[model samples]
Structures are given as C-alpha cells and as structure tokens.
Target: MEVREIALGAGESYELRLTGRGARGYVWTWQVTGNADAVSVSEAAPPPAQTLPGAPLERAYVVRGRSPGGRARIRFAQIRPPYPQEAPYDEFVLEVEVTAATGGP
Candidate 1:
C-alpha cells in the first residue's frame, strides 16, 4: 500500500486527490484526532476512483474538525478486487495532519 501524509494550517481545508490507473475502484477510511473540537475540519467531495477491470464503485466521506491548537490525522484505505484472477488497480493510503495553533491558547 502507498502512503502519503498531509499537513493543515489553522482554518485551512484540504482535498485528497487520487490518480493513476487500474480497476475494482477504491475503498477509503479516515479518522480525525485532536484536542480541538469536531468543527475544525470541512471535507468536500471525495476524489474520483480509477476505473478497474470489474465493477464501477464510488465512496466518499467528510472529516470532523477540531478546536484551536489541536491536530488531526486522517487515514485512507484502498479497496481491492475480489477474484484471485483479477488485475489489481494501484493501491493507496494517506494520512492528513492538521498543525496546532502557533501561540498558546
């Protein structure tokens, strides 16, 4: 699995973009952790998946935000094809981290 890490500044929003080719589509899972409240994050439409050899699938999610001076890490997981005879699309993994506030709260 390929992994990527992202950093976020205060009041900053980000999108996880997916690229490359292959089939069976993708599966994604994310979690946010921080001392801030859950309102600090805003996630837009999830990136589209690369078409694979089998079915066409779609999945999306929004990240919960946090309070000031808090940090969060969002992780994404890739979905694979079922049959052993099927070709594999490029697998993916990601981690997004929001930077804590600069000054003391």
Candidate 2:
C-alpha cells in the first residue's frame, strides 16, 4: 500500500488518476475513512470509446472537500469481483486535509 497527503479548500476538489488492468476484470474501488463527512468522492464519466482488451484502463476519481477544518482518508484497492475474500492486487491511501476557503469575491 502507498500513502499520500493532499490539501484542499472547502468546496474545492482534486482529481486522482488510477490505472489498472480492467481488461482482465480488475477494477478500482475506494472507501472514505476518518472524517468522511469532510470529503466526497465520485468517479468521472468514462470515455466514449470502449477499452481494448489486454490494454490498461484509466479511471479518474474526483475528491471534493465538503467541510472545512477536517481530515479524511480515502483508501483505494484494485481487485477482481466475486472474490471478496481474496487480497487486493494493489492499494493506495490518500490523506486529505480540508481547510477554509481563501480569498474573497
């Protein structure tokens, strides 16, 4: 597993890119831990064309800061479904800190 830290302002968001072997049934999944209310995560819309077999698949997840002055952790894993008991092939952890938005209109 890999860990990374990031900072975001309230209502601000960041994009995380993940690459996996989707062609082989491996998909990326995530969960929010700690201050879950402080952040929200969603997957971006897929591209128009279909992914080719045996090719790497790319996915983008948008992590938005929903509340200020809090921290959250997003855990990600790449695994094949129908084998929930099995271990993940890859994992990543994102530590996020949300702060008050800066500047004025």
Candidate 3:
C-alpha cells in the first residue's frame, strides 16, 4: 500500500514511510518539487536492513509544514544508479496539505 494524500498543521512535521526492494542497489529517493515556501523535506535516515535478497526496506521521508494554505508534493523514485538515461524502476507520489494551526479562542 501507498499514501496518496495527507494533512498537517503549520510548523508541524510528518514522516512518510515508503517501502521498496533495496538489496539489489535499487534505492528509493524523493524529490520535492512544489510548495517550497510552505514546506521542507528531508531524508531522516537510512532504510531498514533486510534479512534476505529481494526483501523490502522502509525509507523515512521527513516533511515539515512551514505555513498554511499550501500543498507539498513529493515524488519517490527507485533508482538503480550509474545510469542517468535509464528510467526508474518504480515511482510514487505523496501529496501534503498544510493547514493553519489552531489557536486559543
């Protein structure tokens, strides 16, 4: 299963966990193209270790909502590396909606 959409508060952060096969040198790397002012993205740590070949690994994508009323779109690609012209093995997209933080009345 994969995440299609998500919601967050201003200044709040969310961790997106993505799973893929990593034993064969194919790694999932993310790129955030939209809503730069309202959000920030980073890779938290290395993916989990797999016990056997062709096993799946979980990668953490750390996304923080910087402001309200904007959307952050992230794309994850399974790259085999050393070949720029070749297409990725897999791709996934995650959309984030940043809402205003509620305050005391």
Which model scores highest in TM-score?
2
Task: Return the candidate ranking by lDDT, descending.
Answer: 2, 3, 1
Worst 10 residues of 1 by lDDT: 20-29
Prediction 1 global C-alpha lDDT: 0.46
lDDT for each candidate structure: 0.46, 0.91, 0.80
What TM-score would you give candidate 2 relative to the actual structure?
Answer: 0.93
Compared with the true structure, what per-residue lDDT tens digits does model 1 show for residues 1-105?
676665655555555554422243444334444443523434456435554456444443444334444544444444343543544444454455556544656
lDDT winner among the candidates?
Answer: 2
Cα misplacement distance, residue 4 of candidate 2 (Å)? 1.0
User: How far in Å is the alpha carbon of 90 misplaced in model 1?
Assistant: 7.2
Question: Candidate 3 on 42-82: residue-level lDDT in tens?
Answer: 88887545467677787888888887998878888888887
For candidate 3, the per-residue lDDT at 80 reads: 83
Candidate 3: misplaced stretches above 4 Å?
Answer: 1-3, 48-50
lDDT of 2 by residue, 1-105 (tens): 889999999989999988887878888999999999999999998844776778897888999998998899999999999788889989989999999987688
Q: How accurate is candidate 3 locally (lDDT)?
A: 0.80
lDDT (Cα, 0-100) at 18 in candidate 2: 86
Please count the clashing residue pairs in each candidate, in the order shown: 9, 0, 0
